[model samples]
Target: MDITVAEALVRCLEQEKVEIVFGYPGGAILPVYDALNHTSIRHILVRHEQGAAHAADGYARVTGKVGVCMATSGPGATNLVTGIANAYMDSIPMIIITGQVATSQVGTDAFQEVDITGITLPITKHNFLVKDPAKLPVIVKKAFLIAATGRPGPVLIDLPKDIAQARIKFKYPKTVELTGYKPTYRGHPSMVQQAAGLIMSSERPVIYAGGGVRISNAAPELLQLAETISAPVTHTLMGLGCFPGNHPLFLGMLGLHGTRYANQAVTECDCLIAVGARFDDRVVTKVSGFAPSAKIIHIDIDPAEIGKNVRINLPIVGDVKNVLGAILPLLKKKENGAWVARVQQLKKDYALRYDRGGMLKPQYVLEKLNEFKDDDAIVVTDVGQHQMWAALYMRFKEPRSFLSSGGLGAMGFCLPAAVGAKLGAPHRTVIVVIGDGGIQMTMQELGTAAEQKLPLKIFVLNNQRLGMVRQLQEFYCEKRYFGVDFQFNLDFTALGRLYGMEGYTVETEEQLLEILPRVLTSPEGVIVNCIVDPEENVYPMVLNGSPINEAID
Candidate 1:
């Protein structure tokens, strides 16, 4: 039976197990939207195209599935750029489908016409411009496959209006094979053996894990390797929940705004075994001073990333889980108890601290939030001081429990992300901790949550300023604060109520402590506006040109 390419596209999505698509409707994509009206696949109408992309990204992180998002041509497609870049930089799996002008209008700059595939070429892992109706099914399948495999990232499909409306016989492929792309899953046997030998010979070693650990589901293997080798573990911002935050051997996050002890341990370690982490500049604050004495063994699925950012002594290109699984059995337990003790001492000596007796400090709110958070609760964060506080104080014991815009450091991520996360993991509690500045960026998503009747806990740290920017100005510009303060700070609780959700405002620690638990249990969507101290700063910050070990509080 012949069906419109739009209908065939929907069939492909169904085959891919795409239960939802976050999108906005426009003229160019009318046929697709019209087709979607009859399908079981739910479409979430976002207030903005950017929200749609972020919602899909949030869904991907929590569910470990390739997220789907769509938008029309021109401004609609361009609006998805920031969110697409966020997914690309963080190595998220997402499939973005955008409608383009009709094939007849190609290169003439028709109404609402723009080269989205060209615009997004640099950011996407791969992208396609579909000019033929017959190839729609294959292209859709390929897009999802490319997005979900081989160091996952966003892939885009630009469907011209005429092709989407054209007729095609629908037949979704059972499997896809991209001839030019095949990722290595297992590490070379010799490399695995070499890793085991290095573990046996090293006395002082640390495991630097990253987002890849969570992506590969290698936490158990990572734990076994750490335990067998008696190594402490530290992670990047994107790697928050790859290991249990409360583990004794855990050294917290490493790099800028990292724990002082974690950075110190990295500085002094003899062997740095890196798994599934890219040595991003933020993680290597001063390249010359980073891991100066360590014999670095970098393990990642992407060979290009092995030496792209920082020099490595050994490079193993394979899936983190598979490589660790191979190496774990060969590894013998070492008696590096003394090194473990030293790492623990460092953690204890330079523990994360903040004002406990203050008016609703951000850190205190996060600590209190930790108490109410279930082990399985998904905590999403927008960028800035609140994100840092969550990183420092929240106890994450499972992968996907902590999701944020790590690489892009996007400000307006949490609120809309929480909506998609709740939909993705319907049974789990989803909490979005955002700052005043970030919340205002996408606070309009509150209406989406209310419409969906999602019971998300939205916590806003109302500092009345862009906290991170203010902190930077204090250090760099002699404390002459500029453009960061919200002079007309709106009441977030009132805004939530306006969106038909429950709302509350807490001015003190005691007031927040009493309300947070109940807020977490709210049956309908709710928002809590906590007035936090503006003077507070995220401590243990590694300043510019400073080594990761020496931080300023």
Candidate 2:
């Protein structure tokens, strides 16, 4: 049967079992929007193109599925760039579709035209510009496959207006075969044995886990390996929630703004087993000083990341779960009693602390949030001091319960992301912890949540300043803080009410304690404007040219 390419595209999406799509309508993509009206797929109308992309990203992180988002040409397509980069850096699977000018206006710069495929080349795992109507189904298939497979990332498809209106007989491909694109799932036998040997022989071993552990769903294997070898575990920012937060062996997050004990343990360990983690500059701090005495055993799916940033004594290139499973049987259990005691001592000595009596603090709010929320609740945070604070205070017992813009550190991510996360996991309680500066960046998303009637607990830590940058200026620029403080503000409580939701203002501990229970248990969406101390900053920060262990409070 013959059908318009736009209709064929929708059919292809249905074939992929896509239940929802986040997008906004525009002139160039009118045909696709018209075709969507006939399908059962739910489409979420976002306030801006960037919100659509971010929402899709959040959806993918929680569901472990390829998230789909769309936008029209030119400015609309350009707006998706930040979100696309965010997904790419974090290895989230996503498919981004953008409308383009008709083929007839190829190089003439027609209305709402831009080379989106070309612009996103450096970031995307793969992208396509569809010129043939018959190939639309196959292109969609390949895009999804590429985005979800082997170190997942964003893939884009540019559909010209003329092609969307063209007629074609659509047949979705049963399987895709891409030459020279096979992912390595199993580690080399010799390398796996060598890694086991290192684990068994070392007296003091520490496991440094990263986002790949969560991406490959290797949390169970990671836990087993850690327990089997009796190694203390420390995680990167993205690796949070992959390991149980309350476990005795867990050293908490390690890196900039990381825990002091985690950094000290990593620095002092004799054998460092880096599972599915890259030696990012933020984590390594002083490259020469990182794991200075440890024999580094690196395991990752992407071979290129093996020796890119740090020297590795042993490299096992394969899936994290597979590699860990292979190495487990080769080793006998060892009781590193002294090493465990040493790490525990460090944990106790540098425990996280804050003033109990003072103005309302962001840390205090997060700790209270942790106490009140369910263990399985999902927390999404925007970048800044609050992000670091949330990472420090929230306790995550399961994987996929925490989501944030780790590598890109994009602001304005929490609100829209919370929207998509709630839609993806309707049974789970979703909360948003965003800073005052970040919330204003995409606060318009409140309308989307209101329309969907999502019961989200949004806590805006209103410090009335860009706290992170101000802290940096305080340290680096000799206390010359400028362009960081906000002179004016909006009534966030009233803003939530304007969207037909419940709102509250919390300035003191009494107010917070009184209102939190009501807001958290509310059936309707609610936003709490928390007035935190303006001068408060994230502690245990690593200064320039200093090793992670030498961080200052």
Report lDDT (CA) for all predictions: 0.90, 0.92
Across 472-540, the per-residue lDDT of candidate 2 in tens digits comes to 999999999999989998888898899988889998988888988778777878889999998888988
> Where is the poorest 10-residue window by lDDT in model 2?
352-361
Q: lDDT value for candidate 1?
A: 0.90
Error of 2 at 267 (Å): 0.2
Which candidate ranks first by lDDT, i.e. highest? Answer: 2
Please give, for residues 1-553, the per-residue lDDT of candidate 1 as tens digits. 9999999999999999999999999989988998999788999998889999999999999999999999999999999999999999999999999999999997899999999999999999999999889998888888888898879999999999999999998999877778998988889889888888887888899999999999999999998888788899999988888888888888889999999999999999989999999999989999999999988999999999988988998888899999999989998888698888898899889988887675778898899999988889999999998998889888899889998999999888888888889989999999889999999898788878888888888889998999999999999899999999988988888888898878899989779878877888877777899998999999989999999998986
- Spell out the clash pairs found in candidate 2: none
Q: How many clashing pairs per prediction, in order?
A: 0, 0
TM-score of each: 0.98, 0.99
Cα error, candidate 1, residue 280 (Å): 0.9
TM-score of structure candidate 1: 0.98
Give the C-alpha miss distance for residue 93 in model 2, angstroms: 0.2
